[model samples]
Target: MNQLKGVVSHHEREIAELRADRELAVAYLKAAMESLDDPDERAAGLLALRTVAEAHGGLGAVAAEAGISRESLYRSLSPKGNPTLKTLLAVLKTMGMRLSVEPEHQAHA
Candidate 1:
């Protein structure tokens, strides 16, 4: 292995790692979902999900399993996209995960 320059870009390396690690995939998405709640970081959140989709499963396969067209999934997961709850659930389920609710930490007054 005699290489002077890195062959794969950082993003490609990240995607490869995510594909290999399901736990990592879940944690990454969990953090990303928080951003979805913030208006300013919504696009970044969507992009994060999109990246996981590309890693865990290709967009085409995920879309098919989720009962959506590939093109539609692409549009819905795009950076500017605002996905419906159904779409979000479908995507998560397709990725072998599900969303859950937990009590947020709040100070009792």
Candidate 2:
């Protein structure tokens, strides 16, 4: 009984760590989306989205959550994928996130 209890406790700790890591991934993806402004943003966002999707299970799982076809999610979030606003929003929403716009910094005269 003591050994069983120890095993359960270890598993619980592992699960908690996984949850924290997943939350970090989600936060990083949100930050990446907010930082988009140049070609780099697209690249970074795609990578971040892919990482989050993989963590949640993969393209198929993410597609299901986003209410899109698996193939569509794969194509859109690929490194070369140019996702539409609708697709982007859907994926973010499925990940418990939303997009926000902030004012750009003023350029020097």
Candidate 3:
């Protein structure tokens, strides 16, 4: 049990550190979001956002920057969360990111 706990803690720290690199974090999250057709990918994307938030300053700081309560931020970032566009955009903005769209294919149908 202690070994498992240690492993979890170690991984959490690694994720926190990995998110320190904005480019990597953005790329990772963008890739995750790009796979939205898969349920697991959606969950992974949300979790990635949570991890990035943790790296930036944890939920409390993110919530403060986004002008939302910490609990709300946590709930919004949870696996089952379906945050509104406003909430999503606000959180992303606080993280120094914005949503962008590009053609899915080089040639249009």
Candidate 4:
């Protein structure tokens, strides 16, 4: 494991940064949410929420507060995850956030 020494993982660093600043976490999540509409980038969006969940509270805590089992939370937030709208709303509500809709900037062709 010598090679693993002094290596801070992306997840760890991301969580730490999010936990340290609420505003940053909000911006981070907002940006991640934008990617949700793109199938090619959706995984990144889910993973981003997972990171914030890991930051705002431990997964277990967030899951419990969101009225879901920890295992469900983990599975739903996985890269290939497909969380239901109910679950997404629940998770966001638990984390003091919510979803909003806005018109895309691209003009209709």
> Candidate 1: where is the Cα deviation over 4 Å?
1-6, 105-109
Candidate RMSDs in order: 3.3, 7.1, 3.0, 1.9
RMSD of model 3, in Å? Answer: 3.0
lDDT score, candidate 2, position 30: 65
Best by TM-score: 4
TM-score of each: 0.87, 0.68, 0.79, 0.90
For model 1, state the Cα shift of residue 2 in Å: 18
lDDT of 4 by residue, 1-37 (tens): 4687789998789899999998999999999999999
Q: What's model 2's overall lDDT?
A: 0.72
Predicted structure with the largest lDDT when compared to the true one: 4
User: Cα lDDT for residue 62, model 3?
Assistant: 91
lDDT for 40 (candidate 1): 94
| Whole-model lDDT per candidate | 0.90, 0.72, 0.79, 0.92
Q: Which parts of model 3 have CA positions greater than 4 angstroms off?
A: 1-10, 106-109
- Which portions of model 2 miss their true places by more than 4 Å? 1-19, 106-109
Single out the weakest 10-residue window by summed lDDT for candidate 3: 1-10
Native-to-model Cα distance after best TM-score fit, residue 71 in candidate 2, in Å: 1.0
lDDT of 3 by residue, 1-109 (tens): 3354345576576576666677888887688677654776677678778888888778899999998999998888888877778888988899888999977856757
